[model samples]
Structure formats: structure tokens, C-alpha cells
Target: MDNEFYNAFASPISVTQNALLKNETGTTQKPPKLMDIDDYNGWSERFGNWVEAYHLDAWDHTEVQYFRPLGSDRKPIPIRELSDEEKKKYKNEKLMVSLLQ
Candidate 1:
């Protein structure tokens, strides 16, 4: 993905830390944990814009099945009610991981 696009999805702080980690360890780590849904929505919006602007092909990778986030009571959060903060955090994390590779 493009740098500008990645930047839009990630927090400035995370980006800086990612650069530092790259310089120090010669390897990067997982993305910081996200806290809410706004983050995820922002990332998805940026990603959508990138795909539209660049006319990129759709992802064709295998889909991994995972459990939905559950609270301490083990009740899954409703999909429509999920938050975006964690998603943004994860997107940054994925970017950091890509930098390492």
C-alpha cells in the first residue's frame, strides 16, 4: 500500500515508534492495541479511498475464521455495534509488520 494511504490509517505516534523500532532492532513488532470503532472506520475509509484512487485489485487471500470479541462475560459484541479503535490499531500494526518483512 502507498505511504500516504498507510499514514491516513495509522496514528502519528504509532508511525514514529514504528520507524524507531525499524532502525533499532532491524525488525518490527505487532501494532499497538486499538480501543474503539472510530479507528477502524477511519482505516476502512482510507483503504477504500486508496483502492478507488489506484484501481487496485481486490484482495484474494484466504479468509481466516476467528471468534468475535467477547466481553468478560464471554458474550460476543454485536457486529454492527463494534468499535473502530482496535481496527485502526491493528491496521498500524499490520503496516509495521510489513515494514519488517
Candidate 2:
């Protein structure tokens, strides 16, 4: 599913911490969402002009990225410390007691 999603979008649109309100004084803004654009081809052409105007790359450039795989209510998965010998003797991993039983 993850692979299929990535292949389709070729990019992941992360939820912004703070949405842009307006272009008021001393207010910075992120680019608009794909759905926000009414015209794809027209926007792409204009976007190319924008990139050139700002001296930016025509292609999408990604840097350090992080993704949350679980819901906000979901508890984080725990990691256990292992000894050197224990690390060397890795075995099949069991997730939960129900699965194990």
C-alpha cells in the first residue's frame, strides 16, 4: 500500500503544523495544495515561471523527511536493549501475545 501510494504521488504531502492564513505584513507562506489548484497544466507552466523567478530548481527537491505511521492516540512501539551476543543471535520477531499464542 505504501509503495503504491508513493508510486502514484511520487511525492508525499505532509500535514503542515500551521496553515498559512494570508500574505499580510511579515507573514511567510507555504505553497498551495494540489487540490487547491484548479488547472494542472496552467499551474505547472506558471509554477515553472515561479521557480525561475525565485532561481529554484524545476524538479522537486526533497531533504530530510519524517513520517508518522500511527494515529495520534496510538502508543509508540518500544525498543529493547540487547547484549552483544543477543544482537548476534537474532530470531523471528513476535509482535503481540495474541499473535504469539
| Per-model lDDT | 0.46, 0.33
Tell me, by lDDT, which candidate is best.
Answer: 1
Residue pairs whose backbone atoms clash in candidate 2: none
- Residue-wise lDDT of candidate 2 within 1-101, one digit each (tens)? 99987756553332222232221111222232333446666545654444334423222221212222333667532234444433322221221111112
TM-score of 2: 0.23
C-alpha RMSD for every candidate: 16.6, 21.6
Q: Where in model 2 is the C-alpha error above 4 Å? A: 1-33, 36-38, 57-101
